[model samples]
Target: MHPTTPRIAIVGGGLGGLTLARVLQVNGIEATLYEADINRHIRLGQGGTLDMHAESGQHALHEAGLDAEFRAAARPEGQDMKLFDKHGTLLSEQATDEDDMDRPEIDRGVLRDILLDSVNPDSIQWGKYLKDASPLTGGQHALHFADGTATTCDLLVGADGAWSHVRPLVTAAEPDHSGVNFVELSITDVDRTHPAIAELVGRGSLYALGDNKGIMTQRNGDGRIRTYVAFRAREDWLTMYGIPFDRPDVARTVILGYFSDWAPELTDLIRYCDDTMLPRPIMQLPVGLTWASKPGVTLIGDAAHLMSPFAGAGANLAMRDAVELAQAVTENPGNLPAAIETYEKALHAYVLPVAEIASHHLDLMISPDGDKQMLALLKQFDAMAAQGSGGDR
Candidate 1:
């Protein structure tokens, strides 16, 4: 720890926390990052390509001095977005590379690795789940971990995701079901085993939509494709289905049963899926999620504004928050509340609009009036592409 620098504690070593740590390190500030997982390798890292906008994700990476490393691993081919109908009819296509699209595709796992490598080796403290955290005198806070360790810091930032333990201290916000749950699947060794799926994903993303359901898939860097069997249902639907959400065999049956009539190639995405089936029920904190200012503590990333994945804004927004927060601290040294106030003031404007767009996209995707709404989205993207603005800025 730098003797004159701030002592910051970042909970949850996801993309957001990792990025914040890197940003702070580049500026000569030290941060201790706590993650719940036993270790980094415990993750399957199956989430699809995040379309990181130029001004958001890319900009944050640049600020962290990770642009070169990020580019080496970025999948420009993953920038392509393709839409299909339930009957396997192709409706739309859009493509980009490293030069044109700022939001180049990179596996979530790969991105985390690059960010993790940028930080100090000892900076991240894994296996520490948040048991509780509280404010102490002299603008410090005590953080208690589930593993019987305790630490305190002058500044605490919750970069943890949806179910953040630190959130209750700032606001009463919590996540509610978003009426959509994704049963995630992966066709590993796509080039060797699942050539059909490899082709279907077409170097990037595939969105096949139908009545109250969709199949979202994306090409991973490792010749594998991460896919999701998305369903629109009431919050209790999965519970009533009696499907073992964690087990692959059971979840696969529940998923394939829903799309029973789909083509063999498509349903094969479920059959050939690996054992790590993730039943990710979408949840979100209320948009415009904010609270009264408090000294020495704040939130970033999903801990701050958790919305649906529809808008593809989660990672970008979270990375952006890290950058803004770092800038805030740099500009207002020794004035903790002033720095936090600066962060929230800028964050509200940046996050609120994106969250609204995300919520709206999720609502439209799951609504009774679906197909046309999807077509409209396709058309909107086409129009943007036509104007030479596919992913510019």
Candidate 2:
């Protein structure tokens, strides 16, 4: 390791990795980011919406000097949420004002563009699919890529996602199925072509949960309605269910069979989806996963704590981790090991409770009485908010 400036390598070009690189550069430190994507354009229109929490995601952007850009692109009205049951009974609805920025929503692709544009294009090595990473003497690491090329750095940060290749260097923990499966579908030109769905989904998100199953939909900025048909099933159910996923029409019919008794309004989402269907199995690491602090290597975001999307904390936490890690490195100066230890300790402490909450929410939403349980939980939250407001008054 260099005594004054340690060589930093960030693997994975997700929000966390990109934020780290941008923040490091803002602090006058240089780091190389390696992403598997062939180019930045490949991520366009690839991911769904993300709500940037004020204290985490937004704070990270502020640290990286992209606050103005993020604010311009964020949608405060996208905080609107509607909850329903299988019978199309509206259980609860929360609508946000245009100025409500507590957790403003933004398209994932747009957020990535903001971070990408903030960093120097020359610092990013696109198409570098990391094969593996090995430890070298004196707290350094050698990153081997799939293209028969390699690089070494004094500090290695794995911002890679759930199946991070660099995670094994620290902990043996792998993500396990959370018993929830999602069939993702989308409807483009939603407002123009699918007026019924646009009306049903409202502005932001609609969640219809019942019979241990769910149909979740969100309106994207590009006039698309992205939906996830989620249900509790065996990890291998998608493979064995015999649905012709490749044929969108046949797959839609087959999928609708599961929700035959569901309301027409909720089932129409699947009936009018585009030709793409993506099957995703929710996976999670242990609630309080931790590892012995290894020098030159550490993890952030999903690489450290992979949880179901129930809590909606994945991206927020990833950006928060980036901010914390960058601060640790910049504050610790040349002490690379100390910086990693500090960041890991803080990450573990903060992520434990969030992981547990996410696990609990996943269980509640996938149970036989999911709708009833969710309604009760929402009422409890309302009561808590009322009490807090009363006390403040």
Candidate 3:
């Protein structure tokens, strides 16, 4: 479409989608973002915190011209991380460097709001859940929505996250359970109401592991301690446990039974949780998955490579993909097919290491010798940090 406006449609208003829209807007390329949420307030408690890395998330934010906003909202102290075994003995703790912005933390909702604010309000169409995408002539596709509305776009980008409907267009890989499930719970106003747990968790993340099971907690930006009770079990194990997720009290009691031999301090995580629980089954697509680029369709973020959160690269890679794809389109303008080919090639190479790290970390974190393995890994990281700083500790 030469100098004419290209009808680019981005499905999913996630960080990647929003970042793509903002970066394209910065380059004078207007694109529409179709979000499934009814509105911005659809989920007040969207998710937990995210740490943006310099090479990915922060880089994308800078490209989108939101560096100042991101810096203002990021929490440097949230980088503090502690690890322990089931006995409640602290294995290793990493103190945060107040001056380091390499991986600053931000709440998922806050980051999303920042991205949303930077984009053109008219470009986001909320509540437009994609139903199907039909290929059309001239490298265009028609998007059908659940609300009986349809639109056509010259370029269709899917940043819709795991279980994406758009992934089928490029690859047939489905997300398989990673042999782990997390029962998520939280304690509100933890600093005051649950001082003990707050102190145990510190300002950032804590991992207590043993017996092939684990209890993980991380402090959110809102002073709440979000906890995940993880089990290396079969896909239907939680359902078979017969614990009612709706009744947090009973569920917490029943869940604690599995960890009866664990230290009381560690078990307290589940004991003092608030009256809400969510079952999260970890799933991941085949590692290093790639596909031949289609004429008018592409994907980013979890849609492109769905991996477990162990590597802490999911969000970072998503934003990185957004920046790369946006720049590809900006550079190639009228030649979208070439742009997509270039973007996909770079994307495949970029995501390979991340996927491998995520897979390896998940295996180590949940294996029988997880505690020893994790502690050794932390010591190696400490040694690397010391060496990088020209010091030995």
Pick the TM-score winner. 2
Which regions of candidate 3 deviate over 4 angstroms? 1-4, 389-393
Model 2, span 49-82: residue lDDT tens: 9988887889999999998999999999998999
lDDT (10s digit) by residue, model 1, range 1-393: 122467899999988999999998888778899999988889756366676678889999999998898888887778788877766777778776647555688878888889888899799898999998999876678999999999988889999888999888889889998889887778878888877777777888887777788888888887778887788986777767777866768777877888887766767778888887767789999988778878788999999999989888899989999999998887765777788899998888878888888888877766554555777977886689789887322
lDDT, candidate 3, 1-393, per-residue tens: 433567899999988899999999999999999999999888768788999988889999999999899999999989899989988899999888887787888999899999989999999999999998988887788999999999999999999999898888888899999999889889999989978888989988999887788898889998888988888988787877777887777898899998898889878889988888989988999998989999889999999999988888888889999999999999997888888999999999989888998888888888776788889878777788778852111
Better of 1 and 2 by lDDT: 2
Compared with the true structure, model 3 gives a TM-score of: 0.97
Instruction: List the global CA lDDT of all models.
Output: 0.82, 0.90, 0.89
lDDT of 1 at 70: 82
Model 2, backbone clash pairs (residues 3+ apart or across chains), number: 0
Question: In model 2, how large is the Cα lDDT of residue 174?
Answer: 97
- Candidate 2 off by > 4 Å: 389-393
Point out where model 1 deviates above 4 Å: 1-4, 245-250, 385-393
Candidate 2: residue 74 Cα off by (Å): 0.9
Worst 10 contiguous positions by lDDT, candidate 3: 384-393
TM-score-better candidate, 1 vs 3: 3
Q: What is the model-wide C-alpha lDDT for candidate 3?
A: 0.89
